[model samples]
Target: MTDTNRTCFMKGQGAQPRRDRSQLPPRKMATLIIVLTMLFFLAAAHNAAAQPQKPQPERPLVFVPGILGSRLVDDNGTVIWGDRNSYLNFPKLEIAPSGPVTALHSDGRLVESINVLGPFWTIHQYDTLLHYLHSLGYIDNETLFVFAYDWRLSNFETAKQLQTFVDDPKRGRLQNGQFDLLSHSMGGIVSKLWMVKEGGAARVHKAIYMGTPFQGSMNAFETLSDGWGDFTNFIAGGLPTVRRVALSFPALYELLPTYDKCCRLGSPEKYTPLDVLDVATWRQRDWLPSEYRANGPRGAAFERGLSEARRVGELMRQPIPGVAQVMIAGDYFDTGLYLYVPTNRQSWRDWNFRRSKGDGTVPVWSAANNFSSIEGTEPSFQQHATIFADKYLQNKLERELLNTAPPPVKHDVLGEIDTPKHEKRRLDLARADLSPRIAEPGANATVTVAFEFETGVTRGDVQPTAQLLQRGAADAPITLVETTTDADLAVRRLTFAGSLVAPAVEDTYRIDINVAGQGDHAVFLTVLSAGRRQP
Candidate 1:
């Protein structure tokens, strides 16, 4: 049977049983009807408030996260991958195989694994995207959903799954049998496969791609051949995880540089059609033992993986006729070129890494589809990792997804000049009025905290709140206060104040300040106090 036929058969086998509404009694049925009606209206009102005042109904949004973005956990709730601690301690921990690309559930409700962490810090994947959409009044599940799949699988399989998700009768199908897609990096490849091979053009209204390597990334080839490098390994915690990721995942092989379309290093020369196995053998001579040269299991796997990748790449080059495509490519950073110099045995470097412009991972030419569809490309200075977090990109995505009017076709380099600097929000204690470092019981003190935003960022409508709590009792709030924004200077400041009262017993008290909205800032304060004043 054909792949599409096999996919349909598999979907049929896994189809979930629908709820039997007819089983309810007459009185229960009447109550259910009333409850459902009330819920429907309440949800409608909530959506109305969240979305812009446009005549069109809110279209459903399906977000596809990039590589290492989805949380992988076992049946017992133990994380398998995508968690910093788990990944770092991968050898020590009982690493469980990711069962399948499936949805996570908690109490019978869908649980989203939208973001993952690097070795030392959190690497936000789609959290910023989702938060921005939510701030614009997009309701979760009702109007927004995430497609979290195993990044190890082929794009073809993932594309098939996306097809099933969009066509599912019970919980799929947004408004008017169409939806908007926002894809980042590798997710864009998956989206392209779905649109081209799985007939997603009929269902997708607008497809927005951010920092997508449509042609493929030379970095993938480098990482698989040489090593993940110090920076990437440090970010991923160690080389083991990177090695496992590079060798195990078929998807990464799909991201190999499309040589035929890419330019050679140090010049604007394009390469001839190159075989995947030949390139792999040339690059990984030392890594791949001499015995397993061309006909070994490793070589066979590479051949198989490359074969599938080539098939997907061929299909991806074809444009979806009905769906509107928006390609957002990043520029400014030095990108890897198609050229690679083999310095010595098992040693190579990208030829034009110091001069080529890209998003630091994907070269600009590759990100722009080698200028094949340059008329639709939107270039920005933001790096591949930060493109989705960019407010400009967010605004553009909103306009394309929500507005009724068709987005204008403009081939221009945007946000390249006077590029906005991205920074993390910070909260700090500005002032405090405590006569004595150690206050007696019932003694009162006032504390003030300040939240500062980066130059380009503006504070959202949701304000910050300050709460005072005792150690070991974070659930209870001793005192609480809200913040007021001061946007007088280039750097906006949000100040929060609260009064703290000492308890009857002698102990240390903690003050916590939290801001709402995406990239929220938080601050904590510890204060020591004696027993209440002697009566």
Candidate 2:
């Protein structure tokens, strides 16, 4: 048995006849079993080592979205602040007069791009940012984290919530106990609060702000004082309830421009400076949304809000040098710079806001953290709501985040005009009119849009894309039915026709008649999706 075992086990691969275990002695069988067992364990260990391991992030990332970016859900996980019907019942989101922020119940928060009008018309909030993060090897719930809070509440409360979120071992806290931040718009304020106030700067390695209203924008006053430029009118159908609900959000008040002498108390030419942070100033001007009149907020209700805004504004003024930060601003369109208060407490609709180069929402000065210089100018012909979706900026951001950027390029920026006009994006926007502006839901309908542009603006350069807006990969755009252009006249006339099945979500459907290199001219069509026809 010993000779057979020794001969058969010789290393060089020659076949040997199989031998029965029973024929071998007990000691030999035990030795064979041990050898085989060892081989088995070695193979198992090798295979286990070969399996791929999940990659860990160097500095884990925490994505913070702006106001209206995070989806608010009730206790039952029913989404309240997303989708088409979200603003239809705007009163449901309102805070009570002199009531605690806890009056409204938005217990659950989801970090996702909002489905703005419907599944097809998604506002590309942070989905693209998230996708880029994932492509860079950020793992979900491990290396990558999302901080979603109810933006309607004061940033003070939201900052406290952010503190709680980061400290949780399963979320913002990683192996290294450090994370990077990507905050957009109001999210930047929330991040700053957590960093400066809540001692979060120690844990944050870096932060990137996109189109943030650091100094603030005059649009906030426009929203509350009068629905002058309020886009909510399109959603809520010019309801006073929209303003009432917006007034309830203390956080919105914080967005009111603290710089640029927020409002002139008297006439446009000669006026006294108004303390925008003062609730009394709001009251004296009779500019509150309480009664839907020009009267300011009920003194008691908005004092706390104004206080919150003042505290936040002070915090924003202070610099936090410990944490590294990068700020990106959009300088394409004209944005609200200052408010002009007319005599007799005139309605804000008449000569509302003086404008300057901004991103349609935030002025360039505000977006760059109040830095008014050439280097701080990251000029892009982009709008405030869509800044994050820019591919060129995204590339720059990737390099900046990774510390792989080349020398910064110098731009010969022309200084903002001294007396800027209260003009919207100074682009030759095509005026679009939808023919037979109504369609039945779920049925294929012929949709044609006629666009009129200034004659001097080059033609064929403006290829009008007609479709419902959404993330690139989510859905196919509407099929083009026809495209035509007329000979140059005083106004260049271009036409684009497309085919689409009417969405049953809402009666009002807008086709984004966006001319390339031109501004948005949305054409709304009435659909009997809700069985209530628009008269």
**Model number with the top lDDT:** 2
Clash tally, candidates in order: 3, 8
lDDT tens digits by residue: candidate 2, 25-64: 8898899999999999999999988986443345778888
Cα RMSDs, all models: 21.2, 9.2
- Tell me the whole-model lDDT of each prediction, alpha carbons only: 0.58, 0.65
User: Candidate 1 — worst ten consecutive residues by lDDT sum?
Assistant: 105-114
Write down the worst ten-residue block by lDDT for model 2: 411-420
| Residue 42, candidate 2: C-alpha displacement in angstroms | 19
> Which regions of candidate 2 fall more than 4 Å away from where they truly are?
1-57, 97-122, 172-175, 225-238, 266-269, 289-298, 347-351, 403-535
- Which residue pairs clash within candidate 1? 50-137, 441-531, 441-532
